[model samples]
Target: MIVSGKLLVSLSLLVLVFKVSHGQPLVPALIIFGDSVADVGNNNNRTTLVKANFPPYGRDFVNHQPTGRFCNGKLATDFTAEYLGFTSYPPAFLSQEATGMGILTGVNFASAASGYYNWTAQLWGAISLDQQLNYYNEYQSIVVNMVGEAEANAIFSGAIHLLSAGTSDFIQNYYINPFLRGYTPDQFSEILMRSYSSFIQKLYGLGARRIGVTNLPPIGCLPASITLFGSGSNQWNIKLNQDAILFNNKLNNTSQTLQKSLPGLKLVVFDIYQPLLDMITNPSDNGFFESRRACCGTGTFETSVLCNSRSVGTCNNATGYVFWDGFHPSEAANEVLAGDLLAQGIDLIS
Candidate 1:
């Protein structure tokens, strides 16, 4: 379906809210799945197959131990749960047995390096969206077994499905500028948004009625992009990124369409665009000094190659900038952006 027609627009505003006023207080339980942005270390690091579990990745984490999360501190998903009074960082589903926790405490199935496309992960093969959905199904079964229907509804009422990814899709595949899809930039994005809508619908079918979703952040602003792609005469292409803005605009439209596609589903948007947009566009307003350059680097854009080793690539000051590594955000950026999203007034569905 073409996404921008007035029919879809009218339907999205016709939301049928689920009633939680039957004497049960809504409690938050989170299930997250996506790329490095939302990953709370689901990769397991059984071998060296994961990112974020290594040094400097979690330097700000408790005890300075690496938990494989992409940010210097808690990810947006972690802080998002905390905003609702659940655990700040959702425990990984794979580690639940060791932690001895129930789903009500919030289980994170998000892997640091996973994506919706099959090609994202190389030899190790990253988690596909379908795989992530399978895990979600498993978690739902666990929830049903644990607290029974009553409390399940309470927690599930507040239970929010958080999916944050996309910058990878472009860098990894979409922006290869291939003709295999036979689509213009807008056409390709429409296909992606539709796939994403289907993914969300699948979750809704399985009973995830509340969701917080985000679009790709500014891909051109990433250190990796600049270190490699930014040095060209087109500094605007290199330094001032607009690819993410375009992708996010498409994503916002898609979210609006998805809200209309399903009845009784609450779709809350997390705008990763303007927050970083503000940072790059107006760096001083948010205390971000180094806007165009990277905190970590080696020869050029601190290309992903340089970011691998902490010994060589540490940045000057993380808080002075928005990006942490080349691709992800600093703790400050995550906090500020996530804080802005909350201020947009996300609450439990009632």
Candidate 2:
């Protein structure tokens, strides 16, 4: 009944390894689709500037090796798989580790800096949602070969599909690009929603039933956003934050409508906005000391490869910071967020 802290951690890791290495998982698998926030390592081999494959990035990960995650450690998707009884993190579909029975554990198709729009991925040469779907189609063939048709179909239908995109459409494109700057926030959100709906229906067609999609986190509070858009007036920052709220609202409504209209679909919008806002507004409440700066580089503008191994000012300790780089949450922050997500959306899959 009373387990020591060290022992508890040991037991948990052992159980996780067992679940990942053996037994039928609670959920057959998890397929992740998103931008940097949920990307594991799908961008590593791609000709993308939006990559995190070098040191200080995965400083706290297993073996202290960088695996292209935009964080100091495991992502929320990895933790979600842990809760779902996975022994190890899901492998990126493009990674060599994703072969054989490892494919049954799941695969991550999320590419950093990519988004709902194909142009978003093109901006950084990352994989677009369309490309991710194509990869999924290829994955289907792999699954059918590994297991019979009936079993493969059952695994896919029972599996949980996780999606998180759209942030880059606003952050990296609409807000900055002169061409996209013509559209109002509402108009841009609509465009993104059109893309989201298309992706969902496409997954549904591919036999996916349970899907968990994360809404945008508070973009205004991201260290990079604050550095790029923050000023004494704070007017521009307020506007971006408002756009995020508007986009999240539309996402909720669309998910609800789609779930009702699409047969056997269970689409749940994970509310990442509120919890992240809470952590930003009150960092101490979530065990974070630095809320507006990252642990790497200048803690303001550096992200992706910019927060490199040669970055002179990378912090010695990352646990007290909410962000690892200017653009992404630190491992500590990810753990808190992932715990909330698993609690909120567990029923949809389990």
Candidate 3:
């Protein structure tokens, strides 16, 4: 079957198109791991009080359906996938939808209230960091079975692994829990760093080279933090914010160190604190009407389950507020933060 030169070229192009279409999408995949900030709905299936699969949570999402996200709509990861041209948000690894091509594309292993430290998740009955890492290993095996080893390895190496955590460690564990009381703020930050560094190294070992880890947001400004520790001179809140800054700095340093130490690694530390602080401190500048309080309930004392359907005084306009609940950012705020992340960290993957 001898073919002419033009016919041969046309056949080659057709084969290329078929291979690409049947293979990975624009951005190979987006494998997410970390805490509530990255969790899509992993916590909903868990036996944890940290679940947010209820009304007023995903109120602003497509179809206004609450899909267990902690925010009023999409999370940063959801926007990230969309920005990278994914048709849908990465499904939770535990969800039934996370199978075949979905698993091949990406999966979210993060759990609400989880953190770098397992103890933080244990406190709230959420999936721990160790467990999430195990889930990634599970995902790798599934993808290999679906697409074969060589192609699966390519997707794994090219994928963007988004990790967001440390909030629960500081707010839900070290700050409030008396059980972990011995460590001072500085010592606690170091503790979290050790785990964080290990997590990145472990991911690299698992073939994740393109990684973007979100730093701690300004914890002092969160409505929940303000309500819990903003009384009196706000010394506790001040201390917490300072701790958060210090930890973020350390995280940045860790990224640099890991990049140098690990071969073919592209790790970026997303500075969420500055952008989020700007939105909270200068709400009008960010087109947000409310910064000091959330849109749910009284805006200062409600979060997670507390920001439920029966919660009175839930704001009609989630877009006008910085936070949807006392702790989580509104969907509008997530979009802004996601934009910042894409701008700052796209190079790492590209």
Residue-by-residue lDDT tens digits, candidate 3, 127-183: 999899998998898889888999998998999999999999988988888877898
Query: Could you give me the TM-score of model 1 versus the true structure?
Result: 0.82
CA lDDT of 268 in candidate 3? 89
Could you give the C-alpha RMSD of every candidate to the true structure, in order shown?
Answer: 6.8, 5.1, 8.2
Clashing pairs in 1: 52-68, 53-68, 227-301, 295-315
If candidate 1 were superposed on the true structure by all CA atoms, what would the RMSD be? Answer: 6.8
Over the stretch 1-350, how does candidate 2's per-residue lDDT look in tens digits? 98896675556556655665676667888888889998888889988789888998898999999999999998888888887777788788998888878887689999998898889899889999999999999999999999989999998999999998988999998888999878899998999999999999999999999999999988988888887888754222877789999999999999988998999998889998889888888999998888877899889879987899899888999999988898898889889988778666745654
lDDT of each: 0.65, 0.87, 0.86
Estimate the overall C-alpha local distance difference test score of candidate 2.
Answer: 0.87
* Ten residues in sequence with the least summed lDDT for candidate 1: 16-25
- Candidate 3 matches the true fold with a TM-score of 0.91
Candidate 2, run of 10 with poorest lDDT? 231-240
TM-score of each: 0.82, 0.92, 0.91
Clashing pairs in model 3, backbone N/Cα/C closer than 3 A: none
lDDT at residue 92 of model 3 (Cα atoms): 93
lDDT of 1 by residue, 216-331 (tens): 66677665675556556424353235656665778878778888978888887777776787887788889888676655554234422246555465775578877777677878
